[model samples]
Target: MPVWRRYLVRDASGRMVELPSRALDKAEDGTSPIPGFAGRCVDVVAAVLVAERGQSPQVAEVSFTKLYFDKSGFVDTGKRERMIRLMLESVADKRLARIPNAARAEAAVRAGAARLQLADEFAWQPGPAEMNEVMLRLDHRPAGQGHTVH
Candidate 1:
């Protein structure tokens, strides 16, 4: 059986927020409009979930690492609309299913980014740039201080 990896982040109240494992995938031709890291960042994922629930995105001080199942799994990057829709449909929390589409979810991410006070450049989307900015913003302690990611 294939090992499954689960990406996750923490809310302001320190609650774990789960995110879609493979939110994007590379095209067969090796060119994807959306970068590979889009939708895979734990902070952005948590922000999307919180914003979807109409709550604040004051996420906890967790960054730099995303969760994985059994310490191993696959990562796909491509057109992510379908996966986002599927995740919304299948998520255990019905509240997060209210966004209705990936675009809305992405909007929530942007809103959450604004709430978090990220720079305008990084706040607009979910990609390596945003991830790096968020990680730098949230990474207050040393690498091994907070929750351990595996």
Candidate 2:
């Protein structure tokens, strides 16, 4: 199996499938009805981040591959999406900001995921009221600790 195949997850019907190109196009072009990232389709994007932005491959793989497996060691797409949204909501901006254009890339990932309907995950953007809270939280964290938040 290819490295990317390791990131595939089974849906509610126990069906595991690759992300189709049409869905990818829809996500990339902003034609989808929702605004979120597809959890299972992020392997390529993660690879690109590592290749272009100097992000560590091991770091990217470890951070993303966790989304595909369940507590029982089975492939599960069910809650993987929730994890993705939580990652975005909690610390993605601060944690990934050092990587240039990381935010936009991540947003696109989320949008594409949403478009594919592979997972129910949605992208999160802090509102005006929440921005201050988010900034405050980020301001308190130390830098370059070399720990993956999610």
Candidate 1 lDDT, tens digit per residue, 53-75? 34333334332333221111223
The CA lDDT of each predicted structure is 0.38, 0.37
| lDDT of each residue in 1-150, candidate 2, tens digit only | 112211222244533334444554444444541122433432221111122244323222212232333333333445555655554544444455566686657855665654444323432223444333322322223344342322
Q: Backbone collision count in every prediction?
A: 6, 5
True lDDT of residue 135, candidate 1: 50
For candidate 1, the lDDT comes to 0.38
Off by over 4 Å in 1: 1-78, 92-138, 142-144, 148-150
Candidate 1 collision pairs: 24-76, 24-77, 24-78, 25-77, 25-78, 26-77
Q: How close is candidate 2 to the true structure, as a TM-score?
A: 0.22
- TM-scores, each model vs. reference: 0.20, 0.22
Scored against the true structure, residue 53 in model 1 reaches a CA lDDT of 38
lDDT of 1 at 74: 26
